[model samples]
Target: MASNGLLRECVQQLKSSKHDYEKVLGGSVEVVWQSVSSAIERHLRLKKGVGVPGLGKFSFIRDFQPLTPVFLLNDRFISSYGVSWKRPPPSLVIPIAELNMSVLGSEAGLPKDQVAQTLDAVCAFVGGRLQKGSASGRIPVGNVGFFQCEGKNLQFVFDPSFVKSLVQSSNDAKPNVKPAADPIKPTVQPNSVANRTSIAMTDAIGSISQLSLSRLVNEEPDSSSDKSSDQKNDKRDHHRHHKHKHRHSKSTPHLPLSTQSDTQTSTSTQSQQILPRFLMLDPLRAPPRHLTSDSKYARVQDSAYERETEDVKNRVARSAHEVEEIARRTKAAQLRYLQTKAEKSVLEREMNAFLHGQMEFKRNAKQQEDARRSSAMEYDAVKILPRDPIVTAAQRREVKLKLRRRLNDQVALKDDLAKQKRAVDQAESAYFLSKLQLHAAHEQEERAERQRIEREALVAGWTQQLAVRAQHEQLHPTRKHR
Candidate 1:
């Protein structure tokens, strides 16, 4: 988050410029702003100033309490000359600001403190967030219009060019659109999915409202948590199988055992139908005779047109009937497929359980035969269990040597543990420092980027000022017309 003092500067300049030229008169006396009545007389007498062959005229107009200069910068007059002043409608400002906030990287690039500061700066006197979002700055001067960015960038738009371009669409007539403030930065990265989607409760789902945003953020399942449950299910499945086998093995003379259940399906848990909400509108009462001025033309056209309409409607009905029949057939086929699948699953489950029983039968028989052979061998030979490797080595070692080695290994193990602990502590410290450094560097980069943009803006502003002054000189009386 970075910003500048230009918005305030623009307002101050506007006020000063207006204050300097409220009234212009012949030399030798203080020229006062005319009284309300006198000003009306002067204004009524003043025609649009004539233009030179290559340069445009300059005029003065008032907005709020300030009288400001309007230049015909584009030859006829600067785009500013044609403004018919009115308080901008609420509809326009609100939507414009919303669009800008969305475009300016989801307000995340700006720190909370800085965002509040900017909001306060632009919204100080009037206009509020809407104008702040739309205007770049609240103060609009006459012809020499300026826009401000958070120390990020600033721009002066020839309001006229914008209007002309907008007009060249539709009827090819651009509306009188106001100039705008400029970019947050030169390389203002659009808010990424990570950032944009990060706007938890009120992110823009674009056309979707805040309610939808709430649903999207809140509706997502915790995927990591889901993975944990899957692991638990695997363990549970083993446990379940163990119990099933143990209980079956103990039973033979009692009631017969039934097979386990079929595998559950996804559709079993979630049932939803995607049906459209169909609506039909009823016809309203016909209008009075005066609403139909051309009775004869209507009468002649109505018959043919009505027949054509009816024919089209009938054709549509037939097509709809065909579609309905196809849909009905498809639904029946789907139902049959589902039923056949259910039957197949049941059969598979039973078959698997039967196989398991057969495997247990063979396994039990083999174990009994092995147990009998082991018992017969035990009568002839004494059984000695195999010793662990460490115990066997200890049997051959001197007690003194074994004790020393044991003590040494204990010391080594402690040292190893200590080393591991230190390594872990260092890792933790490094991780924390790296996180802090990364965050600090990110903020620094953000600041530098913003500053770079501001510098670019200042440069552009200087260029525009030179161009405007050149244009003004072209209209100078002492200089020959270009």
Candidate 2:
């Protein structure tokens, strides 16, 4: 399979010139990559052909069973970069000693000990493989290429194409262009199906010939042995003939004349019998009838055989043509499927990108809306509240002090009112008490005066009664005594 290194290189180049690419395509980095890759796959897989700007046209070649991709150099590209086989420096030939010194220098700006250690590691890896018989391992270095073991020796295989561009600019040492008159040596042809097929055919023919020679050698001994056995049987038959005849004559002596005559005829016929032989047994005699002459019938048979052979060949050719046609159609369909797949992938990527953008936009819009609502709520709250004059810290402090003083004054006034109310209640209670005391005293004095008056009246009455009683005493003395 051809490496995709060229494609990667092209992509890198496109990336380097992305400013112009984006401007022209009106897309971002990812979009450009998707579009370019999609287009390449479509043309190369389905159409079976695609062209690159600074490279060449690429296509699929169906020379044998499985198809392969190939790049047909454009005339411009060919002129700019002529092809030639390239050979990379051998692994064991690394001039690390020289490189290490320069690398260790301060101008290289690399850690000397670390670089030395890395060099030691590389050399060890290479030397170790060499000791282990063919030095077979990979020596990879990113996209640059790698050293690998090919056979007894190590070789490096470059990425993308194995061929190097020989073409150089006219300004670059004038290119040392030579005229066409100079004889050019042709390079070795690559191993391909044609060469393999020819080699296989030669090997088959050689094997067939060897098999035929062995068969002939093996059959020669069998034929000679059979001939010697036949000769021995003939000799044994000659010796037994006379003895068998005598015995047969003794046994059949009483036979009838008709039976005897029939027996005689049978014996004669048996005596005349000869052994069968191969056609080529007597080379001196004329060949078999078929080989000796050709008849009309033979001619007809030959023509029929020829016709059969021709018919077989035609059938084989037709079958092959049909197979080729079917393969062609299948390849075309495969290409179409590839194109459709690429287009679908590109569209899906675009759709995903678009959806992501939409989601991001919606999220941003929601955030903005939330922020606006918050701001509006704050504004509304401010509008509903009463606004006070703005004051500095000192002014606010002074206002607070004034407010405290006013509160203190109001509290004092309330305390005075409460005290006055308590004093008025106490005075009312004292006056009520005093009034009740005075009334009690006055009543007591009045009662005493009444008692005295009653007593005086009683005494006066007693006096008056006493004077009257004295006048009557003389007269009542006698009665009182009585």
The models' CA-based lDDT, in order, is 0.40, 0.47
RMSD of each: 61.6, 28.3
Tens digits of per-residue lDDT for model 2 on 114-177? 3343333333334443434444455442332344533234444434431121112112445674
Error of 2 at 482 (Å): 99
Per-residue error (Å), model 1, residue 149: 60
User: For candidate 2, what's the RMSD?
Assistant: 28.3
Q: Could you estimate the TM-score for every candidate? A: 0.18, 0.26
Which pairs, if any, clash in model 2?
Answer: 46-335
Candidate 2, overall lDDT? 0.47
Off by over 4 Å in 2: 1-141, 144-291, 370-482
Model 1 RMSD in Å is 61.6
